[model samples]
Target: MRIFVLFVLALSFFGCSTKVPCNCKCPKCPKDESKVFVYNEPEITVYKEPQQLSKAQVYYKKQVSYVRKKAAPYWGEKAQVADKFNYVKYAKDFKARTIINFQNGVIRVETTDTANPLRTLKEVIASTLLNTQNPETVDLFSSRHTIHVGEPFLFNRVKDHDGEPIRWVWRANRYAQHLIDTGLKKDAIKTSTGVKKRYYVTFKMKQDNYSNSSELNYASIVKKQAKRFGLEPALIFALIETESHFNQFATSAIPAYGLMQVVPHSAGRDAWEFLTQRPGQPTRNYLFDARNNIEMGSAYVHILFNRYLSDVKNPENRELCVIAAYNTGSGNVLRSFHKNKDIAVSKINRLSPDALYKHLRQKLPYKETRDYIKKVTSAKKHYL
Candidate 1:
């Protein structure tokens, strides 16, 4: 970098005829010619807005921060343990948390309130151990969990790994001192370090991208479904605009069919059964029928609002999670809040919606899901 700067300085000096005399008598250096070189500096890139974070990025960061703190006392500059495993090695192991969860079924985060049970992860977790870094290499359980949320449990040496538990990481003991220092006790230990935050109205879900023009296609049916589902017509329109822009036959790489693009096998099947109480029904392709698509999509979103997001008390918080889950599955969305895979919604239901949103914000596993949440939620404002 210094060499490049020096080269630039040399060029500038030579370019400035008045600053220094041209000593070289070669034809390249013309004494009579007034050499004036205008230095048009390269454009500095500026990012206009903060982007919604992906699940991997969030968890990786959280895991790294956590590992750094816990591994510090052991792997500091002056320690014998640092010889065999440097801070780097220990840190990498902590990152293996996500992998740990899958290999050893997702552990419950335990303390006075949570559980720290150790069980072997499902087969799905180990199946993709060989190829997680490759984006093209899709893990079977990739659909069930984003690899970034990391493993559910921290480094539990006594149980899963053959090591001693980091004393500072003990929730029961650390939290007692933390309460004495702070004066008030916390409800549950934070998944990681730092003061727990409570975000209310101020927090917005991934901001939606506003479309210049709104859709008028199937306007009547959209309003009818929205009304039946007790949703704002604009909210439905926001999803429609984001999903297929009222394209009744729109399909996706996920084979999401029709206007609302409900995945045939998952939400679509459930929504279809919910809208129609019968067994025999075409799922994947027939969702192309505009009315069926709208009913199913709207019903699914409504179900999300009332069921999946029921733990979220605030209307807006519930709305944001619903919008995100519509793109990413609800299980994936819920799992993001706790490091443990089995955190029940009822446990944190009373907590403000913003807490969950912020906790799970950057923590959403998939980049597509994170961006989708932002765009749909941002678009929701315009609809409102």
Candidate 2:
């Protein structure tokens, strides 16, 4: 019994000992796994490691950093710091404010209000970029920039004879602004100085060869001539339209010259000859001279008005008769009036200038004459 008791005591002591070795051991924990460990006499917890940045993100960050550094001088210190930390945010905000996007190899901007901050920024960027001697290529995202090369710019102003001012406002493209700044603004006028003077005899000629001729000029000229001859200005304008298409130097293949398409037979040779006969000159110049053209044309219209006044009492009818005579010759127009005299005056009166032109076109012998009447009548309405 004593030997068995001693053996049991030995077995219990061996089983309780921490130094004893075992055949199986537990698997080690992964580094990523959350585990508690002792460090510097304090308990610490371990977590999974963070991932490194991607290649694309790294490239973007580097690009943003470079741009920020380059823009520092222009944007000042605060912007530079913001760009360094949050370039995408800064760029997006700037774009929104300026209505301009300066990313993706182009700069785009828009402004409904001229005073827009973004518009100002765009101007600054454009000025700065263009002023550089070796500036990088820039693409503006607006249609205004499309006119920068070889496109014409138009400017127009109208004023009444009574000193009333009329304002004409036009939005200019970038090209137009550049042209104005570079002294190319005068190049866009379509009318010559001499032609414009004849059209607007009373109005002061401010600029030479400025392309525009206003309707007011035509109206005023017509008014002055019509008042002198006791005729309607509308009729005068209509004739002028048919004769010259409002061109001062308009000449016809049939030896007619000027805005009135005057022949050399009655006016004499040379522009000066018609007004003041020079010695040794037998005939007036065949070419259309602006002043001579208007004067001769107006005189012819006045004569026709007087000749047809007895049959055509109304100023409108007299004018139409004059235009018909100008197109079909006085003999043919007189014959047509005699043949159609029995027709109701109201029926003839209802005929519009266009209708009369169409009727005259059918009766006219020459195709050119017929077309001439139509063109003149059409132009008359346009100018009026």
Candidate 3:
């Protein structure tokens, strides 16, 4: 009874959905032919084919950068100084480009050397921080320079609009860094002439105009774009809502941008190329733009349905694959079918769409991916 009441509320909220033709069933394309989903699709404008790199290149670059970031000092970085470094004797010269440990406190001597020279006792300690496996040592070293303020300076407390005393708060959220799938990267990375894998220092987003209901034209835009690519508008809306709640300027912990949470370094690259007919590359400016974000995001779904999940025939099952592929990559979605390399199309065909859905629910290794699938499916009904 509760489920029925909720269904009624959802239908009233999003209105009735028009059934659209979907190509999700598991089947191989006929020999000497292509399975073109539509006949009258608009021609994609190719301003220029963007430059892209080999998957191996993208993977190597990402791994190197991750190694560098692990070595660098960032506030969020955590570490407990291993035994020897924590108790190292002070060298004779404290001013050299090495950290000097004394009975009183510690001081870091800065250097501009590009290459890591673990010559000093400090560098030995730094090596631990540089290793991706170790947690950050920022907390270990934060109190090294223990500066005791002799005097306390007091200021008048500030009040808020509600006549309450205001307090300041800060938070930290660890992002998934340098994906561990070496096997996936070499195949997943799609590079081109103008499209380069994007890198970001921070993933922060400011939403000054987010609350203005009048400012959103996302639904209409999503409807138009989805129809152009033969997708249900409600599904797109559900994805956007679940991804960023339709926030035009939303960003994720992975630093994925806009409503789709498209990560420029990965799937975002593929989606961009598909839409503009250009080499997929990273763009800080365009990624936040509402139109481009949705277009690329929708384009990704098209690729997944047509390419990765092509064998998945049922519309409902296809949608499930599309949703999972959006969150965890299409390759990972495929792997969920059978962890072994010998995943046959026949095996996929034998299972009902419901069986495939359950298989995904149970098989995906990541809790995040599993939760994402459920949320997107549940919210889809709301938009429908």
Candidate 4:
């Protein structure tokens, strides 16, 4: 009985003592399985907008200052300067907000409180339109004011814009109710960083008469970046079309950001280092800027041409490889031809530009990358 008791005691001690020594200075040792281990990542906040030259010189201007200390746009719609051309601002009380797309000449306003919704909505719309920089670009007086409400009962009341211009149109949108419900639910959830954000669902506003003339929204920036990097502006335009369709706030699960879909770790890090002679990942706000996005994307294309695929003989053929490299990588472009780098370069040089395009379309590993190269090349002609 004594020997059995001794063996049981030894097993219990060994089972509970399976902890390894840790060098961390925390009060609790992390190596111990019995104790809880929690790791909280630090949050990044961009305080200032990245400076870049613009032709129009229309900077981001706030309409009204918030009384509750409105924070900068942090991956939310509450207070986001979507891009140089678009802005989103929420009222101090969080009951009302406005989304203004200057390029497209559209203004959207949402109010949570249905009581006197028209009054709140009208005030917000008028204030936003008057205070916006470059009022000529938006031309809200000529542009249509579309007010959407989820509540069916309020649609008639809201449409009574009382002595306002005929431009005010109210529509009943069921999605608006869904948006409010979703925002309330999000407000209830606790965040890991202990910071709660209210996210209201937003819809794409209809384009006005002004959008047709403003098709090439960032053409000036494209020209400057292309000239600086020895690239055709048409190619940049094509890439923007294929990548994000010119959506400045576009982000992906791969975590690529902005107009050109630049991955911060890969293309962003390389382009930023090359441009500034410093090594660091660009913040979200930096990439969100239309000028900075085009510059970084154009710079990466330049790197692909001059650094990686420089050995290829024909500039046109080299551009084909560059496009593929932009979607995939330069290594994969080489691999598409041959396993060895030297042999791949030699083989690529031997093929005519047309032949190289055909080979790439057929041999590239990913169907998406293969399709990507074709889409960019095809879209390039539209810009030209």
RMSD, one per candidate, in order:
28.2, 43.7, 19.1, 19.4
Per-candidate local distance difference test: 0.42, 0.35, 0.43, 0.53
lDDT string for model 2 (1-384, tens) is 000111111121011111112111212111222222211111000001111113323443554455444433333332222111111112222221111111111122211212343344334323322221110121111112211222111112212233322222222224223322442111111121211110000122213222124334345666776675565566666666545434443333233444565544322222223234342211223333344455556645554454322345555555665666565443344334343332423444667766665666776545655676666556566544
Tens-digit per-residue lDDT, 1-384, candidate 3: 000111111111111111212243422211223333221221111111122223323543454344233433321122112121122111112111223221122323232222332233233222211212111212221222212122100001112223332122110111112111111121111222222221112111112333122123466778878887778887787777667665444443344556676767555655655445465555634765667778878877776687556676677777887887677655456556654322623456677888877887888756777888888888787666
Q: Write the per-residue lDDT of candidate 4 for residues 211-259, one digit (tens) a residue.
A: 2223356789999988877789889988887776665655443446677
Question: What are the clashing pairs of model 4?
Answer: none
Kindly report the root-mean-square deviation of model 1 from the true structure over all alpha carbons: 28.2
Model 2 RMSD, rounded to 1 decimal: 43.7
- Predicted structure 3: lDDT: 0.43
TM-score of each: 0.42, 0.36, 0.46, 0.53
Q: Model 1: per-residue lDDT, tens digit, 190-306? A: 333332221101111111221322243366888898888778887887787677654444444333556676655446545554456443333544675667778888877766675
Which of the numbered candidates is closest to the native, going by highest lDDT? Answer: 4
* Clash number for each model: 19, 11, 26, 0
Ranked by lDDT, top first: 4, 3, 1, 2
Query: Which parts of model 2 are misplaced by more than 4 Å?
Result: 1-220, 266-289, 336-358
